[model samples]
Target: MAAVRAGWRRGRIELRQSFTNRPELFSHFLWPVLMLVALFFLRHRDFGSTGLLLGTFALPGILGMNAAMGMVSMSQQLTADREDGTLLRAKATPNGMLGYLVGKVVSVAGGLLADLAILLIPALLIVDNLALGSFGGWFTLLWVLALGMVATLPIGAVLGSVFTTARSQGLLQLPVLGLIAISGVFYPITALPDWLEWIGQVFPIYWMGLGMRSALLPDSTVVVEIGDSWRHLETVGVLGVWAVAGLLVAPVVLRRMARRESGSKVAERRERALRRVA
Candidate 1:
C-alpha cells in the first residue's frame, strides 16, 4: 500500500515536471505537429479504388504507433536511471523499485495520453469519416488503447532490463523503427509482401494499429485491411497473449537487473562515460 502510494506521488510529480520542462514540452508537441502536417498533404490522396482517403486510414495507425513508442520511452528512461545511479538509490530503499516502476508507468502512460490528445484534437478536424461521434467508437478506442499499453509497457521494461547502458539503448531504435515501418504505421500492411505481413502480424504494434483503424475508420476502409474484415478478435487475442507473456517475463528480468544494481557498478559506469568523453 505504501509503495503504491509513494509511486503514485512520484509519478504525479514527474508528470508535472515534464509538462513544465521546456525541452520536454517542445518534444511532446513537435512529433505530433509534424505528423499533422504530413496528414494535411495526404488528406486529399486516395488509397487506390478502395475510396478510402490515405490520411483517414493513417490517422488511427499513427495513434497506435505513438502509443507503442511508450515502450521505447520507458526503456530509455530505465537505462538513463541505471546509468545515473537512480536504480542504486532505489535499491537501498525497501520496495523502492516497485515504486519506481509504478511511477514510470504512470508518467510514461500519462505523457503518451497527453501526446495523443495533441494529435487527436487537430486530427479530428482534418480527417473525415472517423467514427469519433459514437459511443461504441469511443468504447472500442478506450479498450484498444488500454490493452495496447498493457501489452507493450512490460515488454519495454524487459528491454530496459536487458540493455546495460544508455548507448546500448540506441541499438533498440533500429529494430523499433523497423517494426514501425512494417507495423502499418505509415501505410497498409496488406500492401506489403506476404512474408513481411506475417512478420508484422507477429508483433503487437500491427494489431494495435489494426485495432485503432477498426475502431475509428469507416467500415468501407475495411477493404484495405486483410480479409476485408477488421479481425477484432485476432487483435484482442494477439495483444492479450503478448500482455501475458510480458507480465510473466518482465518481473523476472527486472528483479535480476535490480539485484545486480550496486554503488560500485554505478561508479564503474560513470568512469567509463567520463573516459569516452575525455
Candidate 2:
C-alpha cells in the first residue's frame, strides 16, 4: 500500500511535468475539435447516420488507436531503461518494480485519457441530435472501452520485455499496420476481403471497433456480422469474447517479460557500451 502511494506521488509529479512542458502541443488537440466542427457543417443533418457512425463509433476506435500508440511508446522507453540499466537501478531501490510499473501506468493513462478527450470533443460538439437514447449503454461503453484500452497496457509491457531495442521489435510494424487496415479504424471492416477477416480476428483492435460501435451506435445490422454478433448481446455484452481474451492474456504476457530481466543482463549491456566508447 505504501509503495503504491509513493508510486502515485511520483506518477503525479511526472504527469504534472508533462502537462506543463507540452501545453502548446497539447492545445493542438483542437484538431479533433475542429474536425468535429467541419464534420458538423458537412453532415449536420446526417447526425443520426454517417456523422454519428464516424464520430461516435469511431470515438472508441480512436481511443483504441491510442492503445497502439501507448504500447509502442511504453515499449520503446522500457527497452531504453533495460539497455541503460535504469530498470536494474530502480529494482534495487526500496520502492521496487511494482512502484515503477504503477508509476508508468499512471503516467501513460493520463496521456491516453487526454487523447481520448480530444477524440471525443468532435463527436459531442458536431453531432447534435445525437440519439444518445442509450445513455445508460454509454456509461457501460466508457468502462468497456477503458477496459479494452487497459488490456493493451500489458502488450506494451510484454513488448518491452521481449525486445532489447525498439528497432528489434521491427516485426511489430507489420502487424500494427495490418491491424489498423483490417480493424475498421479509419475505414470500414466490410471493405476487406473474406480471407482477411480471419486475420484481424487475432488482434484487440477488431474487437475494440465492434465493442465501440455497439456502445456509440444503435444495435443495428449495418456494420458487423462476421464476429460474435455484438448487436445481440445488449449493453455490457457488447464487448464480446475478444475483449475478455485481451484482458486475460495481457497480464500473463507482462509477467513473462518482466521475469526475463535480471541485473546481470542489464549490466552486460552497460559493459558493452563502455567498451565501445573506451
Candidate 3:
C-alpha cells in the first residue's frame, strides 16, 4: 500500500516533468504531427470499391500503432533510468523496485493516452465517416486500447531487461520499424503477399490495428480485411495469449535485472557515457 502510494506520486511527478522538459515536449508532439501530415495527404484517397476514404480507414490503425509504441517508450525509459542511477537508488530501499516499476507503467501509460488525445482530437475534426458517436463503438475502442496496452507493455519491459543499455535499445528500432511496415499501419494487410500476411499476424501490432479498425470504421469497410470480416475473436485470442506470455515472462526478467543493479555499475556507465561525449 505504501509502495503503491509512493509509485503513484512518482508517476505524477515524472509525467509533469515530461510536459515541462523542452526536449520531451518536442518528442511528445513529433509523432502526432507526422501522423496528421500523412493523414492529410491520404484524406481524399479511397480504399478499393468500399467508398471509404484511405485517411478514415487509416486513422484507427494509427491509433493502435501509437498505443503499441507506448511499449517502446517504456523500454527506453527503463534503460535511461538504469543508466542514471535511478534503479540503483530504488534497489537501496525496501520494496522500491516495485514502486519504481509501478511508477514507470503509470507514467508511460499516462503519456501515451495524452499523445493519443493530441492526435485523435485533431483527427476526428479532419476525418470523415467515423463511428465514434455510437456507444458500442466507444466501448469497443476502449477495450481494444486497454487490451493492446496489456499485451505490449510488459513485453517491452522484458526487452528493456534484456538489452541493458540505451545503444542496444536503439538496435530494437529497426525490427520494430520492419514490423510496423508489415503490420499494415499505413496500408492494408490483405494487399501484402500471403507469407507477409502470415508473419504480420504473428505479432500483436497487426491485431491491435485490426481491432481499432473494427471499432472505428464503418461495417462496409470489412471488405478490405482478410476473410471479408472483422476478426474480433482472433484479435482477443492473440492479444490474450500475448498478455499471458508477457505477464509470465516479465516478472522473472525484471526481478533478475533489478537484482544486478548497484551504485558501482551505474557510476561506471556514467563515466563511459561522459568519455564518449568528451
Candidate 4:
C-alpha cells in the first residue's frame, strides 16, 4: 500500500512535469498537428468504391496507433533511465522498482491520453461521418483504449529490459513501423492479400485499429472489414491474451535486468555516451 501510494504520487509528478517542460510540451503537440494536416487533405478523398472518406476511416485507426506507440515510449524511457542509473538507484530502495514502473506507466498512459485528445478534438471538426453522438460509441471507445494500453505497455517493459541502452532501443523502431504498415492504420485490412491480412490479424495492432473503427465508424462502414462484421468478441479475446501474457512475462525479464545493474555499468555507459559526444 505504501509503495502503491508512492508510485502514484511519483507518476503524477512526472506527468505534470512533462506538460510543463518546454521540449516535452513541444513534442506533445508536434505529431498531432502533423496528423491533423494529413487528415485535412485526406478528409474529402473517397476510399475506393466503399463510399467512405479516407480521412474518416483513418482517424480512429490513427488514435489506436498512437495508443499502441505508448509501448515504444515506455521502452525508450526505460533504456534511457537504465543508462543514467535510475534503475540502479531504484533497486537499492525498498519496493523502489515497483514504484518506478508504476510511475512510468502512469506518465506514459497519461501523456497518451492527452495526445489523443489533442488529435481527436480537432479531428472531429475536420473529419465527417463519425458516430460520436451515442453513449455506446463512447463506451466502446473507453474499453478498447483501456484494453489496448494493457495489452501493449507490459510488452514495452519487457522490450526495455532486453535492450539495455538507448542506441539498441533505436533498433526497435523499424519493426514497429513495419507492423503499423500492415496493421491497417491507414488502409483497410480486408483490402490486403490473405497472407498479409492473416499476419496483421495475429497482432494487437490490427485489433486495436479494428476496435477503434467499430467504436467510431457507422455500421454501414462494416462492409470494408473482415466478414463484414465488427467481431467484438475476437477483439476482446486477442487483446486479453496479449494483456495476460505480457503481465506474466514482464516481471521476470525486469527482475533479471535489475539484478545485472551495478554502479560500474552505469559509469561505463556514461563514459561511452561522453565519447560519442566528443
Candidate 5:
C-alpha cells in the first residue's frame, strides 16, 4: 500500500510536469491533429457518418498515427535521462529505479488519456454525425490503447538504452515513419498490395489500428475483413511477445551501454560542446 501510494504520487508529479512544464502531452500530438483536419477538408465526400463504410477509419488513423510520437518520445526521454546522468543517479539510490519506472508509466498513461481526448472531443464537437454510439466498442478501444501502450513502451526504453547518441535517434525515425505508412492506419489494408499488407500484419500498428477501430466505432463501421475483434488473441499475443522481448533485452542493452560509458567519455562529450560554444 505504501509503495503504491508513493508511486501514485510520483506518477502524478511526473504527469503534472509532462502537461504543464514539458508538455510532452501536447507537443507530440498537435501536428497529427492538424493533419487529420486538413485531410478531412480534402475528402469530405469520403469521410461521412453512415453505413459500414462510414467513419471506418477516423479513430484508427488518429490512434495509429500516434504510435510514432509515443515511441519517439520514449526513446528520446530515456536517452536524455542517460545523457544527463539521471539513470546512473537513480541506480545509486535505493528503490530509485523502481520509482523512476513507475513515474514514467504513469506519465505515459496520463498523456495518452489527454491525447485521446484531444482527438475525441474535437471529433464529437466538429463532426456532428460521427459520434460513437456503442458503449461496448468504447471499452474495447480503451483496452487496445492500453495494450498498444504497453507493447510499445518497452521498445522505446530499449532503444533509448541501447543507443547513446541523438544521431542514432534520428536514424531510427525512418522505420517508425515507414511502419505508420504501411500499417493500414490511414487507409484500408486491402487497398495495399498483398505483400505490403502482410508486412503491415507483422507489426503492432496493424493490431493497434484494428483494436482501436473496434472500440471507437460501430460494429458496422469495422473495416477489417479478418481478425478476432473482441478478445483479439492474435493482437494480444503479438503485443505480449513484444513486451516480453523488450523486457528481456532492455536490461542487457542498458548494462552494455553502461559499460561503454566512462567518466572521461562523458567529460569529453561535454567538453566538445563547450569548445564548440566557445
Candidate 6:
C-alpha cells in the first residue's frame, strides 16, 4: 500500500514535469497537430457510398491508434531509463522498482488521455455523425480505453526490457507502422483482403479501433464492419486475453531485465553512447 501510494505520487510528479518541460510539451502537441491537419483535409470527403465523411470514419480509429501507441511510449521510456541508470537506481532501493513501475503507468496513462483529448476535441468539431452524446457511448468509451491500456501497456514493458538501448528501440517503429497499416486505423478493415483482415484481427490494434468505432460511430456504420455487426463479445474476448497474458508475462520479463542491471552496465552503456557521439 505504501509503495503504491508512493508510486502514484511519483507518477503524478513526473506527469506534471512532462507538461512543464519544453521539449516534452512540444512533443505532446506535435502528433496531435499533425493528425488534426490530416483530419481537416479529410473532413469533406465521403467514405465510399456510405455518405459518412471520411474524417468521421477515421476519427475514432485515430483515437484507438493513439491509445495503442501507449505501448510504444512505454517501451521507449523504459529503454531510456535503463540507459540512464534510472532503472538501476530503482532496483537498488526497497520497493523502489514497484514504485517506479506504478509511476510509469500513471504518467503514461495520463499522458495518453491528454493526447486523446487534444485530438478528440478538435476532431469533434471537424467531424460529424458521432454518437458521443449518449450515456452508452461514454460508457463504452471508458471500458474500451481502460481495457485497451491493460492489454497494451505490459506488452510494451516487455518490449522495453528486451531492447536495452534507445537506438535499438528505433527498430520497433517499422513493425508498428506495418501493424497500423493493416489494423484498420485509417480505413475500414472490411476493405482489406481476407488474409489481411485476419492478421489485423489477431492484434490489439484492430480491436481497439473497432471498440472506439463501436463507441462513437452511429449504428449505420456497422455496414463497414465484419458481418455488419459490432462484435462487442469478440472485442472483449480478445482484449481480455491480451490483458491477462501481458499481466502474466510482463513481471517476469521486467524482473529479468532488472536483475541484469548494474552500475558497471550503466557505465559501459554511457561510454558506448559517448564513443558514438565522438
- Alpha carbon lDDT of each predicted model: 0.89, 0.62, 0.86, 0.90, 0.67, 0.90
Clash pairs for candidate 5:
137-215
lDDT of 3 by residue, 136-253 (tens): 8888888888888888988888888777679778787778878988998667799899999999999999998998888889888787889988799999999999989987887677
Tens digits of per-residue lDDT, candidate 4, 1-278, equal 77778889988999999999999999999999999999999999998887889899889878988988999999999999999999998889898888888788888989999999999999999999999889999999889998999899988998898787799977898898899889987778887899999999998999999999999999998887899999999999999999999978876777778899999999999999999999
lDDT of 6 by residue, 1-278 (tens): 78789989988999999999999999999999999999999999998898888888888878988898899999999999999999998888788777887888889999999999899888888887889989999999889999999999888888899897999988887888789889997788988999999999999999998989999899998888899998989999999999999988887777778999999999999999999999
Off by over 4 Å in 1: none
Show the colliding residue pairs in model 1: none
**Model 5 off-target regions past 4 Å?**
1-9, 22-29, 32-36, 39-43, 47-56, 128-131, 227-231, 259-262, 276-278
**TM-score against native, each model:** 0.95, 0.71, 0.93, 0.97, 0.82, 0.96
Whole-model lDDT for model 4 versus the true structure?
Answer: 0.90
- Candidates, ranked, lDDT: 4, 6, 1, 3, 5, 2
Model 5 residue 269 CA deviation in Å: 2.7
Candidate 1 per-residue lDDT, tens place, 2-92, comes to 9889989998999999999999999999999999999999898997777888888789878988998999999999889989999888877
> Which candidate has the top score in TM-score?
4
Which is the better candidate, 3 or 5, if ranked by TM-score? 3
**Which 10 consecutive residues of model 2 have the lowest summed lDDT?**
231-240
Error of 4 at 74 (Å): 0.6
Ranking by TM-score: 4, 6, 1, 3, 5, 2
Candidate 2, superposed: residue stretches over 4 Å from native? 23-60, 128-134, 167-171, 221-224, 227-278
Candidate 6 whole-model C-alpha lDDT, 0 to 1 = 0.90
